[model samples]
Target: MKAVVMRNQTLVVEQLTAPQPAHGQVLVKTLACGICGSDLHMYHHCENVLSGFRNANIPVAFDPRQGLVMGHEYCAEILDHGPDCDKKLKVGTRVCALPFVISPTRFEHIGFSTPYPGGYGEQMVLAEPMLVAVPGDLPAPIAALTEPLTVAVHAVNRAQLSGEEVPLVIGCGPIGLAVIAALKARGVGPVIAADFSPARRALAEKFGADQVVDPAVNSPYASWLQVAAPSDYDMRSPLALLGLGRQPRPCVVFECVGVPGMIQQMIQHAPPRSRLIVVGMCMQSDQIEPLMALPKELNVHFTFGYTAEEFVHTLHALADGSLDAAAMITGTVGLDGVADAFTQLARPEQHAKVMIVHD
Candidate 1:
């Protein structure tokens, strides 16, 4: 099979052996796959990645240096079943799957595993238990968003958001937009989305953000405060309070941008008793002052991935247009475009969910 193979710190279109499903697994024809933030991380950290290996005391099971096929946010069609596969799935059924386990002894992240392969290729193997049927009406490209959507959904769940807490999502990237979608799906609203990118902020408003904040304009926190109503806390401190905006106070801060010092920024700016849900995948080391969070008594939650139910829910939200996920897709590219797409995603002012269509 032809795949975008990553070799020596770069991706190249190369022929590789198609993955055969093992026992209890299903072979899926790659239909559409979304390039993920983690894929970019894998591409950069091929030789020296720490997060993948830090999960366990065992040696790194997935070494990108060995020519990896990277993609996990995918929607595929069932082609065949390996021996002892589940009885429910039928050939030609469209589906989204969790990268449950790469091998019995290793972790189950699809794009990172060389043995189990990934959706970047023409075909890949998924464990039967991980498959979730994609609705017949959902377009292949939009369906590819299930995994990332679930990631946002799960983060919202971690926030435990109710109507009382105003949502302030930092970074209007894909996950941040997913947070907005999930918030809207639950009828939780009056959201404040922050980003430096004008294009991204516009997308966020279209996705149900009540107001958008440009961090470059007078400190995003100040703008957020200007638009938001105050919580019960009588914040007397000059830096924390100006009483500018009449909208609801931003009580839940979703830290979706995973770059350096973002967490600290959110922490420094968060209101008293607010919860900071960290959704961004920051691969490098960073620091935050405990003193910033201490005064406000902020609840900081680190979020990763999603649940099976949430994954299916994301699919349903997209299918029903409850989430308007199709709007999230700003562009599409073929296999060869993967390299440039990675570069473009780094400065995501113009792109949201760029689909890698299998030709």
Candidate 2:
């Protein structure tokens, strides 16, 4: 089998031996896999990522020096099952799964670690328990989106909105766009999205953002204030203790931009009592002023991957047409073109989500 791997911090395509499924695992042929921002981060900052994992005491199975296959968001077709597998789904069934496998000794991340190759390869092994069959007539490229969309689902779930709070998504990248789609799917309204890129702002609207803003031209926070005004109790005035001033309405801000200083910016600018959810994965050290958010009484939440239930829900949503994420797939490339695709994705205006499609 041919696989594209990260070798010496460079993407190299090589012919490798196909891996057989282990216990409780199933073999699947890659159909379509999305290039995630994390993949790009790992490609450029492998040493930093590994060091961070070690510092956090998190066990990392991947050794950058040894080369690792990297891809996670994927749709695949079932080929065979390993020993002790129930094989509930037929051999030809198409499916998507959370990108991880639970081994008897330890849990291994599918695309980030060794032994278990990622969707960049033509064939990969998946934990049978995590596999969710792609339903109806959804195309492989769209089906591959289940993984990334689940992140948005989980972020929204963590927000635990009261149905009154307006949502402000602060970025128009793929993850940010997914958050917009998830908010709309759940009937959350008056969504405001901000991005410097005009192309991303357009995609945000397509994904159901009620208003889009270019930070270079207008303030997204200002747009949020227009729709969500505080009721009573002004934070700025001492007389507000008597409920004399208008307080900002409940607002949930999604910090989808992973770059440094974004968190501090939100802390400084977000409305009082706002719930800020940091969904982006920042790879470097960032500074935030706790004193800035002290008076505001802001609630900050950092969200990671989705839960099992959220993943399943996202898959079903895509299948039933409740979550229309087809617009996110802007480009597709074959295995050999993976390196160039990575380069193209560096320009936000050039693409939203690029997929690696296998024949």
lDDT of 1 by residue, 215-259 (tens): 888566665565554553345454454443343455788999887
What's the C-alpha lDDT at position 82 in model 1?
93
Q: List the residue pairs that clash in candidate 1.
A: 101-108, 102-108, 226-245, 228-247, 229-247, 229-248
TM-score, predicted candidate 1 vs. hidden true structure: 0.92
Model 1 global lDDT (CA atoms, 0 to 1) = 0.82
Per TM-score, the best of the predicted structures is 2
Provide the TM-score for each candidate, comma-separated.
Answer: 0.92, 0.96
What's the residue-level lDDT of 310 in candidate 2?
91
> 227-326, model 2: which lDDT tens digit per residue?
7875443445655323346666688999998999999999988877789999999999999999878877889999999899999888989999999999
- Once fitted onto the true fold, the runs of candidate 2 whose alpha carbons sit more than 4 angstroms away are 230-244
Provide the overall lDDT of each model, using Cα atoms, as 2-decimal numbers. 0.82, 0.90
